[model samples]
Target chain A: MFSMTIIAILMVVVMFVGLYLKSSPVLQEKSFWQLLSSSEWKPMKGEFGFLPFVAGTLWVTLISILIALPVSLLTAVYITEYAKPYIKRLVFPILDILAALPSVIFGVWGVLVIVPWISQHVAPHFMDFSTGYTVFAAGIVLGVMVIPLLVSLFIEVFSSVSTDLRECSLSLGATRWQTVRKVIFRQTFSGIIAATVLAVSRAMGETIAVLMVCGCVIGIPTGILDPCYPIPALIANNYGEMLSMPMYEAALMFAALILFVVVLFFNLLSRIILYRLEKRLG
Target chain B: MRISKSKKISEEIAKVCMCLAMLIVFGFVFSVLWTIFSKGMKAMSWDMVSKLPGGGFYIGKEGGFLNAIVGSLYIVGASTLIGLLISIPVVFFLNVYLKKGSKVAYLARLAFDVLFGVPSIVYGAFGFTIMIFFGLRTSLLGGIIVITLLIIPIFIRTMDEATRNFPRDILDASFALGATRLETLKVVLRQIAPGIATATLLSVGRAIGDAASVMFTAGYTDSIPTSLSQPAATLPLAVFFQLQSPIPEVVDRAYAAALVLTVIVLALSITGRFITNRFSKNKV
Candidate 1:
């Protein structure tokens, strides 16, 4: 049993090492900074500039975080701090159902509904013609995908604020909204930050759904309407065909490594904050 | 008077905002469920589930996704079994063998937390690298191995949360009697049976729904895999691959596949709720 615990700890290191080893050829070919900063990505030509994909990932994740944060925070607050008990009970199952739906399903839905809607209605309002498959569309769908996760995590965080605090605030002439704003939000502020960080990490690494909607193009997206490729999408779309090119696998592996390290860093930061929060709350 | 009136109005406004947020979320959920059910039900048929992808299936021909259904069940079943074997002891060790607040336990929990966040795509790349190193082709076995890795952290974390809530006095009482540590561990396991059920539920949902991790590792096939070494298909991949087809019928078939996957997940979640409720009632 003790050995098993040790193995669990080592597994993280092993994964990092394995990915690094596989990606070393690409790293040796060009500097890590060069790979990240350049925009060119012709695999057959052996030019592996990852800037476009990195920028795409940031764009989609940022838009998603922007879209999800407010709605989730507000909804979670309403559920835990404002809504009646029965409402909480009814809403939770729906969230779980939404969460359980596969990413591919979300992708399919985006393809069927969002892409066409944007191409027809939203894009026409602003531009002459646009395919609905853009970072904006991916962001909207990803935002919806992350809502259940954010709301659930936020609910847990809000629940950690004791009932006594709410009562105390209310007794001091604070309205329900004021109590929530001043007491509940203030109390769970760090936890909310942690939850957001975790969600951002998730959005950054999410594949397939984003791949289906983001148009999977090669260039950096200059606008929300433009097609873009994300790192995870790049890795997923190209891995099988990458064998034909000499360093293609290595390049994809390096993209994975970058994603792994970035997400790992955020998760570690959030976990530490959450651990401290848990201990303090306890 | 003006300040207090303004405060009261602001409170009402805030309440309205929160309710609007709730409405928006509920709206999205309703739309997704409606879209999938309405679209998928139209395409759903007996042949979709019962028959294999016949010739020219992708080109709007007569065939179903039996390959993906059987392949999904095969991969998810074996992966869940393997993941449970690896995660159970580690969860038990974390909750039972280690002292509370121990540095090792803390580090292990942190590691699992990070692992839980690592994307499935990373797991796919890592698995692909290992498969290449061994000169192995993508097969059901590869899918099983990678998914086990992908889900172990989920299993451990869910079970660990349950185990952490377990009463320590129960362990001391068991030990005060004639029970050995192993026997006491069994006692602890029974106490947290609901947690185990919940863990299984979550891991199974994740494993079955996952496509990216197995995308490169599983190597999709048109026929069900008869051997561990053979490539297999899965429902999520089926939805994704079929949707890519230019043909409208094939795309509708993608909805059918999504419906199947969604139904399986919904059924699992409901069954899991029932099992957990049943187990939890037995607890003191």
Candidate 2:
């Protein structure tokens, strides 16, 4: 009975907090709107706008997903449908350990190695730009960070396709590629899309690595080679310097709300897609 | 026969490519491990582990990470234990007592989902705001609260999975023997105790590696925490500080600290896997 009451109270608290944050007068005020719309993000002057940060986040997330999704899907397909057992055993654990590496190390590596290499070589050759810290660089690093997740998810989805399906396709004189494309891809389309969305969300929420590489500039990035500030980076950069009570509270609330929504949407979507896939596959 | 030859060629190429991909992945992992080990091992002597970080910039000469190490242990230990205590019971209540398709269960699951996705930084902000408002700023207790909140969702989801995976026949057999509901739970459900413990250990792995959540809430202090109310530095915080410093020694110390943190997480993961394997074998 006590446990039930506690669960009930916790449930009520969750809804209450969610609703209050959604409907708070502080969030709805004209000043809050003005603050959110303005492009200036000076904490000392108490000017805060989320526009550039949000745009940066969207741009980086889009770029990272574009890079990660294709490579990961191809890698997954190759491993699941084409690779031998010995190769699969060797490859899968490597990906797992890569996924488990701490984000801080990634951040340090980005700062020390990736940024310099890009500045010296890649950026200069590609865009005639000599800078290391750019949206493109950060997005690439983010792609690397999220690749393991996408690979693992797609591998699971692909491997779930029945051996009988593959055998039947092969028996009909279809090539391995044809079997994968005709059978496995068609079957796991929804799961793949869900995994892509989940990967996008992970890239969006990434903080330390992006902060190290993204240069943290507060403006719309006109080119992929330009620097930009992501939402999480902005929050990490400004939280300590926020002087006004309202500004600080509002920034925290806004960052929390944005993160909450992005993460929640992907989590629910992934869960739903996986549930449907499980039901159908089982 | 022609088709088989062509198929063999393509299969061989694909296998080669897969092998190369795996090599690339391992190459990245080994590069990272080498970087950390080469720099970290040189600095991580017994004296370094036993002393505290000095106020000055000298790393090898002045002080060590004794306080941060102890504080990490204290904070992660306390928070993970508390989180497991609360979450296991809640997971049990939801999985066992609540009927399927019940409104309460639905809401409970929803709450868990939301909590799981909530950013660790937001938890840090919330804990910071609440603790400051309650005059508990920069305190170990504040850090514990924040870490506990961060781990709760993880523990709940893990324990929930473990419970759902528990065999129903065991429960039925106990009940068939005329055991009470609680007694049946103790006998049948408790048989999966090691699995549940493994889940909680995974939670600890997550908590120990977390940096952003504890950054604001913990409010780093160089000194050892003598009381729950005192502020303390964790290994992550120490690493962060060292990374930000201009001194070479300090940077090396940061690498050492990172290595320590990584080893701890690796150890936890291995132990969790061992326990899980042992549990599965026992069940079989």
Top candidate, metric DockQ:
1
User: Each prediction's TM-score against the native?
Assistant: 0.98, 0.88
* Alpha-carbon lDDT, every model: 0.90, 0.74
lDDT of 1 by residue, B1-284 (tens): 23388789999898888999999989988888788999999999999999999998888999899999999888889889988888888888887788888999999999998999999999999999888888889999999989999999999998998889898899899989989889998898788888988999889999999999999999899998999999999999999998898899999999999999988998887777667757777786
- TM-score, predicted candidate 2 vs. hidden true structure: 0.88
lDDT of 1 by residue, A1-282 (tens): 788788889988998999999889999989999999998888888999999999999999999999999999999989987788889768877888878888888898899888999999899988999989999999999999999989988988888878888899888888888898898888778999999999999999899899999999888899999988999999999877988775998899999999999999999998898888777765
Model 2 Cα displacement at A15 (Å)? 8.7
Docking level for model 1: medium
Q: Would you give the TM-score of chain B in model 1?
A: 0.96
What root-mean-square deviation over C-alphas does model 1 reach? 1.5
